[model samples]
Target: MSLLEVSDLRTYFYTEGGIVQAVDGVDFSVNAGETLGIVGESGAGKSVTVRSLLGLIDPPGTVVDGTITFDGQDLHSLTESELRREIRGSEISFVFQDPMSALNPVYTVGSQIAEVVEHHTDRTATEAWDRAVELLDDVGIPDAAVRADQYPHEFSGGMRQRVLIAMALSCNPKLIIADEPTTALDVTIQAQILDLFEEIQDRYNTGLIYVTHDLGVVREVCDRVAVMYLGEVVERGRYEDLFNDPKHPYTQMLMRSVVTPDRPVSSLDPIEGAMPSAVDPPSGCRFRTRCPVAIDDCSTIEPPDYAVTSDHAAACLLYDDDFAGDPPVLHERTTGGGRDE
Candidate 1:
């Protein structure tokens, strides 16, 4: 079984405007030792999905429906205390976007790391400190002994990220959810961090859910990729299949925009139009407004998932039953017929 299985997960925010369905009917699973990249635009629900798994959403936000099963146990069914003491850090860890905000500024980086070990395990302060230092060393931080004494501000953005990673690994979690982990770093540092994730996953056999808006990073670190549009996943396939041939309109548009070093400067084509608001996303297919091949029916009826191959699938009317010829056919049919009630 997969290490983490999320089915029909819906995260909604009860705002004054209305209910904002941040993550609607999302389903995916991450197997042990595998890396799954969730790629999308800034407001496409990638963060909300992972945050819900950790029960971080509160007050205005709620996991309205569905199940989040981690290691055969339903996370939503666990008590708050049970989740914090048994699930979080112990079985699952998170590497957030910005270490500056994630790590307590008042505390030294070493203490933050030590606290995780101390809280999760029956270790004394000194033992936890030693383990924290060892974890820092494992993630390639030099002079771990002295660096552990430094504050978060004392480290560079890259180094701070490394420290956060160390903290995430302090408990040797089976799964790690990294949400835009390299966003604040430079290109060189981003590459280094991605390499670190690959190395750690290989060595520790940890399941990873790497969430980012940057498709380039996804290509580098993911075994399989899922592309989300608005609040739903529109496309998913193996890395090679996704990059080489994207079936969904949104995924194809994303591929065209990737700033790969090998690509010609003129070949980079950015997808136009901002994502629709989650409070009232576009009717039918949420991505229809921006999709080039969007038909009248696309805005009217939600497209059913179509199998491009044995392992690859996409949600778009282009491959729906209305289209003639092949099972994996792509056609341009214009009609905005089915609108969500």
Candidate 2:
């Protein structure tokens, strides 16, 4: 069985204007030692979906419907206290996007990690501190002992990110949810962080749900990819399948926009228009408004996850059995790892 399975996950915000459906009917899974990359444009509900898995939604927003199963246990069924004590940090953990914000300025990085280790395990304060240093070293922080004495401000952006990772690994979690952990770092640091994730998974056999907008990063680290649109998953399959021949129009557009070292940013084909607000999104297919190949049925009939291949599925009317004719496909551009419509 998969390490994590999320089904019909719907999280909504009760706003004065209207109910903002931040995460609506989302479903995906990841196995041990596997990496699942959730990729999409901003406002595609990638972060919200992962947060909902750990019951992290705050007031004015809540999970209205869904079952988040981690390691065969229903996370939704666990109470807040239960989740804090039993699930989070012990079985599952998160490496948030902004490390500086996630860490407390008052506490040293090692103390912060040690606190989590103590909270989740039966280790003594001294033992937890020692484990913290070991974790920092494990995550590639040099001179771990000296670094352990430093505060969050003393660390660089990359080092702070590594500290967050070390904290996540403190209890040896079965799954790690990294919400764009490398988004704020430079290319060199981003590559290093990606490599760290790969190395951690290889050594620990940990499952990972990596959320990001960069398909290039997805290509480098993800074993499977889920393409989210608005609050729904538009496409999901092996990374190669989605990049080489994207079945969904949204996925095709995304693949075509991949920025590589060879492909200059000026030559990138940008997708038109911005994502619609989650509060009262368009009826039928959520992506229909932006889909170039949208048909009349796309306006009235909400497309389901149609079978695309043995291991691939796309929520597009074009992939439905009732649809006629073949759909357009992506071709690898001359620029390595780039796709063209």
Per candidate, the number of residue pairs that clash is 11, 0
| lDDT tens per residue, model 2, 302-341 | 8899877877989888877678967745434563563321
Local lDDT at 172 for model 2: 97
Q: How close to the true structure is residue 173 of candidate 2, measured as C-alpha lDDT?
A: 95
lDDT of 1: 0.87
Model 1 clashing-pair count: 11
- Local distance difference test scores for all models: 0.87, 0.90
For 270-304, candidate 1 gives per-residue lDDT tens digits of: 78888989999888999888876677777889886
Best by lDDT: 2
Candidate 1 segments whose C-alpha is farther than 4 A from its true place: 325-341
lDDT of 1 at 248: 88
